[model samples]
Target: MFLGIDIGTSSVKAVVVDGTQRLIAAASTPLAVSRPHELWSEQHPDDWWAAVEGTVAELRAAAGRSWAAIGAVGLSGQMHGAVLIDGAGRPLRPAILHNDGRAFGEAEELNRRLPAIGQIAGVPAMPGFAAPKLLWLAHHEPEVLRQARHLLLPKDYVRLRMSGSLATDMSDASGALLLDCARRQWSPEIAAACGIDLSLLPPVLEGSAVAGELTAPVAAAWGLKPGTILATGAGDAAAGAIAAGAVNEGDAFISLGTAAQYFVARESYRPAPEHLVHSFCHGLPQRWFQMAALLNGAGALAWAAELLGKSDIGAMLAAAETAFTGPSPLMFLPYLTGERTPHNNAHARGVLFGLTPASGAEQVTQAVVEGVALALADCQAYVAETGALPEQIAVNGGGARSPFWMKILASALGKTLHVQEESGAGPAFGAARLARLALTGEDPAKVCTKPRIAAEIRPDPALADAYGGKLVQFRNLYRAVKPFYQ
Candidate 1:
């Protein structure tokens, strides 16, 4: 048995899988993000540790005797979070998350100072990247910077507690804006430019390599044997791609979780900074992928459901589906936490336009779903420009379970979407497979086969035509409101 853990924006999930790649058991613990200040998102590292422990305990309880058979562990987590640690491995403060937009000024300053930053890092210097968060701390919270001795991404910090080692995998490190991504290592020059010492960063390792053995205390606490291998895992999106069998050229998947991502695997590196598309190393060796990310995804749907006074999102979606005969006059911009793809604007905020007295819960809810679909359509346009379009895209995440949203997305993008039997189990399953590779020395291609398809969603000609018109209006609305946000 292998163990896989994912530290996500709103929860911590763990899964147990056998050698045949079948899931044995799984558990998740809920988490909350604190927005103490406007445009800021933070989570306490201690809360993450507690959630990880709690979820692992739940998994152990479910696995029973099979728990002791676990031989290796793997981790996957939200990317680009900044976790500052003191000399003794204590958190200096709450970790700033990827959706936080407080560092917009710092991102611009870095881009102004380092002209080749996008080329070096394989991504634009955006506020969500870790380097800008560090710079923001240096300027506004100097005391925290003064005492900080190390920086780790969300999963690496968890790994540190498990194995008493400070290290990160190349896939997670790529999002930090401190890595020479093409070379798969930290760039001393970029670190120096950010006024950060290279020593503050953890050592980078391959995603499938052994990071360390579990410490005896943690092993005993989790009811695992001592000296179990801990594989260097990946960021959540890359792991999801692995689980979807998107490891080859032109293979792609769209994720609709806390954040939305359109990922396409590539055989070689192809940087498209001008389009704000992310080029990063893949979880496996000698591979890469291009990603277009939006900060708001299923989270926007949740917000709309609460605002409409519905306790259940599924019911809200059903209402929206019943009301979806044609496009509504109401339109929404799903930029609740700013945006990443195509436009690198961090000051942008959500907007609801064309509201009338006739507008009600169903119209507003459908608008929210359509709005997200339009934003992803914009992202898909840019990804298509890179000539990495897939024959069919795998769709997964919390939102993927909604038939209404999947139909909307398929029509908006005009492509077929494969819904797997294990639709939302991508990241945890991928991490477990990576653990299996590390423990058994098996080929990744053989280990990460695509799951069986439960169903396929295709575009409706009429709905696609309607969305095509709505797409133009959506772009115009953003252009009209861009200056107000600035």
Candidate 2:
């Protein structure tokens, strides 16, 4: 059996897989994130450690006979969160998460320090990325920076606890903004510019390489053999890509999480200035990926539900099932949490317009859900602008569980939506598969499949025509609201 662990913003998930890459058993536990100050999302490294141990034990219980045979481990986690550690590897402070915006000002300073930052990163210097978060600590929390000997991201932290190694995978390192993504190595120039010592960073390893092994202490405590191989895992999204079964080019998945991104695997790294989609190295060498992010999806839907909804989720979906928008002059901009990809605006916010007293909850709810879907369509259009249209899209997440969201997204994209029938699994299992590949040099293409469609929703010409018009309105909202963001 092989083990894969995913450390996410909300939880840590662990999965045990056999040599065939078949998932044997999986387990997860919540890892609460704390925001002590505005715009700063943090989680205790101890909490993550507890989660890793707990989830692994749960996986052992679930995996049964295979537990004693496990030979490898890997991890996937939330990208860009900074985990600072002392000499003996104790966490210096709570981890700074990917969603934290407390470093926006430092991001600007870091931006001016690099000449071709945009060209190098394929995305603008944003406060959410790791380098900016590190700078935030340097400027304000110098004590933490001074005492901290090494920095690791979410998954790497878990890897360190398991392997007694300081390492990271290329997929997760790409989010640090310190990597020369095309070359798949750290940039010394960026290190100098950011004023962070290069040694403080972990070495970049490939996603599938054997990272380290479980030491005796961790082994005994977790009921595993010592020296079990640990593979440098991937980021949650990349792992999700594997889990979603998009192992080759032309296949991709749209994730509607606290944030959202559209990803397609590629054979090479080719930057697109027009679409501004992120061009980064893939988990597989000689391959690359392009992703467009929406910054908000389920997050927006959840916010709408909280404000305009009272009933349970099923009842709410039932109440808001019907749609009427383009012809009605109602529109929504689902930017409640800023945006990435095409537009790198951090000051943006979501809006709902064209409300009437008669404009009941259905209209607003449909507008929000459809607006988010259309915004995703906007990402596909960006890909279309770049000349690569995915023949199929795999939709997954909290949003994918909603049939209403799936049907609307299918209609808006004019593509078939393939759903995975797996029970409550996402990026973590994906991380395990990638780790399996990383360790055994296996081809993930052979193992994964988009689950049989529990049901397929064909696009109605009428709905498509209406959404086409609203999509135009949707794109313009960002441009029109530029001054507001500035």
Candidate 3:
């Protein structure tokens, strides 16, 4: 058996996979985000560990003796989070998450100061990336920055607690904006610009490599064997791609998790910063992926559900689907937490235009769904600008559970969307596959084959044409509001 863990922004998930790649047991624990100030998103590093413990305990209870058969562990997690640590390897403060937009000014300054960062780092400096967050710390909290001894991504921090090691994978490290992505190494120029030394970063390794062994104390407490190997793992997006068997060139997928991504595997390093697409190293060696990443996805739906006093998101989507006719009467901009890819604007805010006295919850819900779809359409267009678009696209994550939203997305993009079995378990399942690859020395292609498709959603011609018109308005609306945002 192999253990796969994913430290998501909203939860920590763990899964147990047997020798035949069957998911025998799985569990998850919810997490909370602290937003003490506007545009700030953070979480205590210890909370993640506690959540991991919770999930592991549940899995152990469910899997029984199979837990002891675990050969290796692999991790997948939300990327670009900045977790600063002191010399004692203790967190200095709460980690600033990928969606935190407080460092927009710093990000802009970074781009201005180092014009080559866009080409070298695979994407232009963005507030969500680690380097800009560190820059923010340098200017606003210099004392903390001065005292910090190490910086780790979210999953790497979790790995440290499990294995007492400081290391990271190239796929995760690439999002930090401090890596020479094409070279798969830390960039001294970028580090200097962020007021951080190369020593502050961890040694980068491939995702499938053994990063460290489970420490004896942690192993004993977690009811695991001593010296269990921990694979380097990957960022959530890369891990999801691995699960979808989207590692080969031209393979593509759309992830609709807390945050969303439109990803395409690339054969080599091809920076497409001009299109605002991320060109980063894939989990597998000698491969890279181009992505148009969004800061909001099912999270937008959850927020809307809470706002509308709807406790059941499924019910909300059902209501919205029933009310949907053509395009929504109201247009919603789904930038509640700002946006990336194409726009790259951290100041953008969500707006519901054309709402009237008669508009109700269902209309608003439909508009929100349309808003997210339109945003993803923008992502598809920009990703298309980089290279030839993939003919087949896999859809996964929390939002993919809603066939209504999948239909909306299919029509909006005018393409078929494949929903595979266990789509919601993507990252954790991919992590398990990586663990298997590390333990058995198997070919990743064999171990990471795509799961069986559960459904295929094809575009509706009438809705597609209507969405095409709405997509034009969506783009125009963002440009019109851009000047007003600071």
Candidate 4:
């Protein structure tokens, strides 16, 4: 048996995969992020490890006796969250999450030094990336920065607790903004500008390489045999790509969890300078991906539910299903939290520009769905700049649960949404598949996605024409709101 784990912002999920990549058992436990105020999001590093122990205990209780000796393990987690450790391995303070945009002011200053950053990382500057988060810590929480000896991404901290070793995967490291991701090495220039020595970062390992072995303490606590290999895994989304079999050039996938990003796999490193899509190294060797995050998907729905409807999420979807949208001019700007791709603005807020008192919850719900689609379309436009339209787009994350939203997305982007073969298992499944890959040395490229032909929502020509006009208006709304935000 091989084990795979994914540490998310709000949860830790574990899965056990047999040699054939068949999932034997899976479990998840939630972890809380303490955001004391607006412009802050933080989590204790210990909170993640506690959940790992809890989940591993559940895994052992369920599958410990029957399985053969564990051969390997792989790990994936949410990216860009900063975890600081002292020389004795004690954490200094809470981790600053990728979603925390307090560094927007810091990002502007960093952008002025963009020529050097672009040459190294092949991507534009963003506050959500790790380096800025660290810079913010240095400025605001210098006591923590002063006491810190090593810094790791959230998942790496979990891995340290599991195997007593320090490591990070290239895919996750790429998001740190401290790496020359294109060259698969640390960028000396970025480190200098941020006043950070590259030594503060963990060693980069490829997706399938052995990161470390489970130590005696972890082995006994988790009831695992000693010396089990732990394979260096990837970021949650990259691991999800491997699990969904979206691993090669031109293959595309989308995840609509707390946040949404359109992931497109590519063979070489390339940044879209014109469209502002994010470029990063992929989990597979010699592979890369371009991602455009919408910043709101399920989050927008949750807010709408809290404000307009009750707290029931299913009710929002059900209401959206009956609601009228095709004939209306109501527009939803999904920038409830600022946007990353295309606009890259942090101050932008959500706007309901065409709302009338006559509008009901369904129309509001439809606008939320359409707003997500338009943001997705912006990503499609970015990839079009590379002269390739995604042939089959695979859907994952919470948005995949809503058929109504899927229909709008399909019609909006004019692409068939191929639902994955399994229920969305998130990135834990990715870790399991990669763990299986390491043990058997199987070729990942051959494990292509055979997604089921779920009910296809063909593009409504009339609705498409209407949305085309509305998209222009949608873009205009953001522009009109730009001054207020600035």
What TM-score does each of the candidates earn? 0.98, 0.90, 0.98, 0.93
Q: Candidate 4, overall lDDT?
A: 0.78
In terms of lDDT, which candidate is stronger, 2 or 3? 3
Candidate 4 TM-score over all chains jointly = 0.93
Order the candidates by lDDT, highest first. Answer: 3, 1, 4, 2
lDDT of 3 by residue, 373-396 (tens): 999998898899888986669999
lDDT of 2 by residue, 1-486 (tens): 677787877677778777665667878887776869767778988898988888877888888888898777778888878889999999989988777777888888888888566567655577778888888888899999899888898888888878789898787777888888778888887778878898999988888777888889999988888777887878877777777876677678887766777888777666674566776666656666778866777777767777984546556767777554433456888876566665666666787877888887777778888878888888887876544666567776667888877878887888877766552366766766765665567665665555455555666678778778778888887678778874
True lDDT of residue 54, candidate 4: 92
**TM-score, candidate number 1:** 0.98
Q: How accurate is candidate 1 locally (lDDT)?
A: 0.90
lDDT of 2 at 436: 67
Residue by residue across 140-189, what tens digits does model 4's lDDT show?
Answer: 88888788889899889988887888988888888887878778988888
Clashes of each: 0, 1, 0, 0
* Candidate 4 runs further than 4 Å off: 58-70, 324-329, 447-457
Q: Please give the lDDT score at residue 394 for candidate 1.
A: 93
Candidate 2 stretches greater than 4 Å from native? 19-22, 308-315, 322-330, 359-364, 443-456
- Could you tell me how far off, in angstroms, the CA of residue 484 lies in candidate 4 after the best superposition? 1.3
Give one digit per residue, the lDDT tens place, for model 1 in 60-124. Answer: 99988889999999999999999999999999999999999999999998998887888888887
